[model samples]
Target: MPDELHRIAAIRDPFEQLRQATARITAAQEEVTELARLRRRVIEGLKDQGLSYADIAQQAGLSRGRIHQIRQQGPRPEGAFFGVGSVTIATPLKREAIRARPVVAVEDVAGAQRLGDLARSLRLEPTFETIPVGGQIDLNRPNLVVICGPRISTAVAETLAQDQRFQFERAEDGPWTLVDRESGQVYRSGQDETAPRNWDVAYLGRLPRPDRNGSVVIFTGIHPQGSLGVVQLLCNNLAEVYSATNGEDFSVLVGTEYDPDSQEPLSVEILTPYHLLGDLS
Candidate 1:
């Protein structure tokens, strides 16, 4: 009886082993949660220093919603346990931060005015700048939004010229056509070629900046009306437009149909799904 008891004590119990493993897992999970909290604190610090939420999300490999969630939570209390020990993380001083408000460059006063209204509606507070057609631009700014077609906004034209995914072309007295550079597919506004012009094609894309510090959003069209339509779409259907891009660097073409008499947009339709640019990050 004594020998049997000794053997039972020496044998490993699966249930006991599972209990010990579970305890270790719980400890590891706690540590991970602590680290995540610290990470959110650091993100908030960077945001306070003027880094845009989109830029932070790109750098951290996280979604903008996640970044917003962290910011919305506000600051953590002091003496919070950051790891195994209760360490009160100190907030760092503000660094020299880049301007968070983007610059919205347009070709004409009308386009600039429309863009300004759209920005205000979206709560973007972007600076509006009017540049001459075919003029040279440095594009040194961290963030920019260009409006109008290639004939007017040279920046938008030049950017599209360099991009191999899509091309915008217009012939003498013909409708503007957006060509898929890879697939050779062509898209134009309106169904009938002979029908009175009541629709326009617009291009919207987020591309990597030359400095690689941030991104540039291009909203241009083959015609002036097209540019206005793009802005209207942005202001009216921001969530739907943004959802298509999903906060990534992408290009999309949209067609807007308007009443010829009133010149008011009747409907806006997405011409294509978001086409992602490769590895802009």
Candidate 2:
């Protein structure tokens, strides 16, 4: 309300006042809509926990019929796993060995497109941006999905370092890999070994933003194929993923087995369970 419009009587221009009023009303309506969706989501959770409509109504002081109606209205709660309203998907621009200029990879574009389509299907607006050569993006923004690996983004690397469950590290001469800090298990892309295969592993997680006001979804892999596989996995199993993570700050490792010729994923698996980091600072 910092820029909220004052009384029309105090305004000298009625024309500008009308525009201000309209904008304020629209913003209020949007806030109301999101609040209603959140309430509905809570009711749905109560029901999911084996509570009857009557029980939920009693706890909330609403009628059973109204509770049931609320359950059917608004967007699905799982959709919040991505974002509310609009979402921004950021891919990285990398300097390949042969290319003189850094460029967005074809595989990254494909992955971003799939993620954008997923956002659209959930009734949310989707926008795409390519992280510039340095991979320095605004991490304070809300509803952001970053698909750049740590090797590519210092900002993203700092954010990932806060999550203690999994460590993304690379040796002096080896490929970038993921390590289980607790068990000392290491995950590496199949294409990196001396005898390469058609599979890759990736990291998927909702980590706290730099400001700690909210969270950002981070998905990255050792290679472009690995990130693409994360999208393919989410496109099919977002619900299960949502259920496990439940809108919390968490990280998980995923593996994508792909065809060698086309680099298309043949199968996707959750390499580790959701590692919650809600207590992290």
| lDDT for residue 14 in candidate 2, whole number 0-100 | 81
lDDT of 1 by residue, 12-127 (tens): 99786667667666666656655654676678668768999999999989899988887666333111211122211111111123763333322234555655555443223346
Each prediction's TM-score versus the true structure: 0.55, 0.85
* Clashes per model (N, Cα, C within 3 A): 0, 0
- Compared with the true structure, all predictions reach lDDT values of 0.60, 0.85
Query: On residues 1-281, what C-alpha lDDT tens digit does candidate 2 reach at each position?
Result: 24354464366788987887787776776577677778888887888899999999998899999999888876666678877777899998888778568888888999999989898776577999989988789989889999987888999999999988798888567678899898889998898877888889999989999998889999988887888899998899987888888789999999999887787889999999789897666
* Cα RMSDs, all models: 19.7, 3.2
| lDDT assessment of candidate 1 | 0.60
Query: What residue pairs are clashing in model 2?
Result: none
Candidate with best TM-score: 2
